[model samples]
Target: MKKIKVGIIFGGKSAEHEVSLQSAKNIVDAIDKDKYEVTLIGIDKQGSWHLNDQSSYLLNAENPKLIQLNKSNDNVAIIPGSENNQMIHASNGTGLDKLDVVFPIVHGTLGEDGSLQGMLRLANIPFVGPSVLSSAICMDKDIAKRLLQSAGIHVAKGLVYTSANKGTISYEKAAAKLGTPMFIKPANQGSSVGVSKVKTKKEFEQALALAFDYDNKVVVEESIIGREIECAVLGNENPKASLPGEILPQTEFYSYESKYIDEKGAELAIPADLPEDTTKQIQQVAIAAFETLQCEGLARVDFFLTEDGKIYVNEVNTLPGFTKISMYPKLWEISGLSYSDLISELLDLAMKRFEKNNRLKNTVWDD
Candidate 1:
């Protein structure tokens, strides 16, 4: 049997660049060798795409802070509209292998904000995760919250601000509306790259400055005092949700360092202890949010479960972290799907969606 050529695209010009490398390494290590042919495509912080050797695509692979993409490889570019789904050498334009599907593990900004997805769509390649519209909607916290709220899903009360009018909303005004102890973060970033928990006016000012440094828009959300629960979702059309998990953050919040750099920053309780009805409710809400956002393939739907049993949808991660310790795959694993099998399922779903999309009429002919 012919092995499927799978391209694992990782490392990007995002704050989560190092985390992407870690996730890519885990995928490359655990992918079933007999079933699929793996190709490593690493993007540097400068946004250059390189065809890296699978054996030596990463440096300091064990250490999150130092892990980086190995740039000692041939640069490549996707050939848009190619019939064979080919990637070409950037300099010489020679043909590379035809990939059956691409699993883009790039986590933030250009990688996750529909830029790469749009490019892949134009290139006529099957890529994992959500569609361009869904990716864009989920990446922007402000837009996602609004959409979710409109659908009758509970979301944190927040105010969105851009560079143009960032000064108009002062910390005092925000406090009056959102109360003390708010969460400030970049509207379009992931992995909590520029997220901050602030209770004082000075911290709020600093947090806004830091968040704006990552993106033009910022979100100040009233912190929900509840257990941080997450549910992993999979499939297309009719998706399934994994047993919910809880995060015990050692810090004030799950900061960038806690999520990636520090190993003991948080304790994950898989299949979080909850009543049977509450668990069922979480699963239902997870799938509802996934479908509500038009997410395909997979996503990690985060929620705040209040002590009184109130649930609030936090955010949706279209491409959640896939590192060995990441909750996305771990949740699925605990729910019966192993890491390698999950990868295969995602690739299959991508191909299925691609075929279904191709069958649709692009240009209608009048009879």
Candidate 2:
């Protein structure tokens, strides 16, 4: 049987660039080589795409803080409308072998905000994760929360602010509305890249500055005093949710360091201890949020479960982290899917969606 040529695109001009490198390394190492041929496509912080040699695609692969894309001379560009679904050498216009599908691990900004997905769609390529619209929706916390709330799903009370209105809402005003110890984050970032927990007025101001540095818009959410629970959802039309998991953050909250740089920053409780009824509720809500956002392939739905049993939908990660320690894969692993098998299932879903879309009539006149 012919092996599928899978392109793993990672590293992007986002704050989560290092995190993407770590994820790509794990996928490259664990994917079934016998079933799929892997291609390493690395995008540097400067946004240059390179066809990297798999062995040396990432520099300082073990160190999260130091990990970066190892640039190569084989810079490449995607050929839109190409029948072969090929990427070409930017310099000589030489075409590389067609990729059966792409498993994009780019986590934030241009990578996750529908930019890369749109490019792949134009190139007529099958890529893992959500569609362009879903990607954009999920990446923006403000819009996602509003949509979830409109769907009868509970979301944290918050206000969205941009540079134009940044000075209008003072910390005192925010605290009066949402209470103290609010969570501030960039509207369009992931992996908690520019997230901060602030109680004092000074901290609130500082956090706003930091979050605004990452994106023009910022989200200020009331800190829900509840267990941080997460559910991994998989598949296309009929998606399944894994048993919920809980995060025990050693820090005040799960910061960027806690998530990636510091290994001991958080303890993950897989199959979180919850009532059978609560578990079922969480699973149902997870699937509902996934479908509500029009997410395809996979997503990790996060929630805040209060002591009184209230469940608030936090956000949905279209392409969650896939590192060895990441909750998305770990939850699936505990729920019966192996790491290698999860990758295969995701790729298969991508191809399935691609075929379904291609079958739809593009023109009124018959070819």
Candidate 3:
């Protein structure tokens, strides 16, 4: 049997670029070499693509302190009008061999905001994670929360402020309506890139400006006093939610630093200490949110478990981290799936989705 060629695209023009690199490193190491031929496609900070020698780049990336993309390599590009989906030598106009599937670990901004997904769709490639519309909706905090609300899912009250519109709503009005101690963040970013917890009105303007620097839109929500619980959901249609995990961040909240930079920044308790019913309830909501947003392959659904036992759908990460200690894979590990097995499963699902899509009849046939 031929080994499937998998292109793992990582790094991007996002604040989560470093996170993406770590994820790609872990994935490249964990994927079974016998079953797949891995291609490490690095997207530099400037949005340039390059075909890196796997051993040179991925191996170097394993060193957390020294992880950085090696610049000197064959620059690549994904030609938009080509018959086969692939990366090509940018200078020579030579096509990189067609890839069986794309495992896009790029976490935020252009990478996860449906722009990359759209390009892949145009090239007719099956990539891991959600569809274009789903990616776009899930990437936008405001849009995802609104959709969750419409689906009868519990979400904190929030307001959307678009810098482009010069929105008329004042910070005082926002505080009055959503209450004090609000969480302000970029509407379309991930990994808590520009997220801030405004403890008082005095900090509102600063947080707003910081969030707007990342994106034109901002999502300000009434802060929920609860434990940070997360559930990992996998599959396309018949999805399964893994055992819930609790993130005890040493910081006031799970900021970007808590997620990646500091080793002791957070504590993760697999199969969180919750009543059996609460656990099941979170799992159900997770699967519901995954399907509700039309997510494919996998997603990490985060929720707030209040003291009163109420659950609020915080946000869904369409492409959660795959680092050694990341919660998404950690939750699944405690649920009986190994890191290697999870990677294989995602690739299989990508191929299956591609085959299924191709099987659909697109044109009218004379009967």
Candidate achieving higher lDDT, 2 or 3: 2
**Model 2 compared with the native: what TM-score?**
0.99
Per-model C-alpha lDDT, please?
0.93, 0.93, 0.88
lDDT of 2 by residue, 281-319 (tens): 999999999999999999999999998999999889998
Off by over 4 Å in 2: none
Residue 73 alpha-carbon offset, candidate 1, angstroms: 3.9
Candidate 3: Cα lDDT at 347: 88
My TM-score estimates for the predictions, one after another, are: 0.98, 0.99, 0.96
Q: List residue ranges in candidate 3 displaced over 4 A.
A: 58-66, 165-169
- Candidate 1 residue spans exceeding 4 A from truth: none
* Pairs with backbone N, CA or C atoms under 3 Å apart (clashes), candidate 2: none
**Candidate 3 clash pair list:** none
Worst 10 residues of 2 by lDDT: 78-87
Q: Could you tell me which residue pairs clash in candidate 1?
A: none
